[model samples]
Target: MRKITAGVFISLDGVVEAPDQWHFPYFSDEMGAAVDATLGAADTVLFGRKTYDSFAGAWPEREAAGEEDAGFAKKLGDARKIVVSTRKLEFTWRNSEQLQGDFVEAVTALKNEPGGNIALSGSISVVRQLLAAGLLDELQLLVHPIAVRKGMRLFDEGDTAVPLRLLSSETFQTGVLNLIYAPAEPAADAGYEDAKAHLPQS
Candidate 1:
């Protein structure tokens, strides 16, 4: 089965929105390599509507301009992209498809298909939904040092608590924390609240 891995850039305060505002200052060769490695591992890419629109608008233009990361842009342009949307969308990006129907069911079916893995980036709502549905296999958070006090947090208020187990962690010279986690199995004797309480905070 194909694994569904989510890669997100988040602030120290858990804010995942508008990473462009604060994410670049800390970008380094190491960070670039990490991103390259993540992309290399995935054969397919999944996106929420907003992320799809943003990427389709920028990557194609970057590829056309022959930018510094033109190779990366080309890879993104060529990869099979599955955009989750309820309404019909004009997908001008190459190798892209729209997924409509029950969100969890579609994603579950995708996960069961034969593929390397499905990589998800910058799709907050989609990530939350997948986590809640127990469809996410791995979560990789690039935690920056700065905190943007006001923005959409990764785990917002009233969201259901999902337990996770830390699989690995790395600290970069730029102080970016690359934390990897997997969904934790609920203990046989533990209640939902107990299981959540034992999980680490992101």
Candidate 2:
């Protein structure tokens, strides 16, 4: 089975939208280095349509400046990109295939396919689905301190994003806090007062 990793830049309130407005300035050397490090290690990429559009516009041109991450960009351009979507899109990026069937089924099949690790970026909707289905293996959450009163979210399911257990956390030089999490099992008697009252003896 393949390991699926998600790299996200989010806010304290779970906001993962438009970090470019206040964070992730790829022009800086520090940010460049971080991207190089992350991209250099990953062999496969998974993303939602929104992220696919963003990358399709930017990454193709990133190598023009001759940065160290340029090679990674080229690799990204060539690597297999699995795009999860319902609506039809005319994306023409090389080495990409669309996943249009059942969400959970498609991802599970991908994970079972013989391949290296997969990395997801800016696919908040897809992340929500993965979390709902318990398919996410790891999360690289770049948590920024600023609060955006409104925007997209990291893992907001239609009803609610499932609870997560913070496995580890670290601070970057840019003050972006990275929080790692694994899906936590829900309480047996959750949301039921009567059930909680009759909980098993410890």
Best model number under lDDT? 1
Candidate lDDT (C-alpha), each: 0.88, 0.75
Candidate 2 regions off by >4 Å? 25-39, 155-161, 187-202
Instruction: Return the top candidate by TM-score.
Output: 1
The TM-score that candidate 1 achieves is 0.89
User: Model 2, residue 72: displacement in angstroms?
Assistant: 2.3
lDDT of 1 by residue, 16-66 (tens): 998988999999988888777776567899999999999998999999999
Error of 2 at 134 (Å): 1.0
- Predicted structure 1: lDDT: 0.88
Candidate 1 has its poorest 10 consecutive residues by lDDT at 185-194
Q: lDDT tens string, model 2, 1-202? A: 9888777877778788888886754235554554544544567788888889899888778765569657767888878887887887777677788886888888899899897888887688887778778999877777777787698776544665376788787676767776777788764555677678787878
Q: What is the TM-score of each candidate against the true structure?
A: 0.89, 0.80
Q: How far is candidate 2 from the true structure (C-alpha RMSD, Å)?
A: 5.0
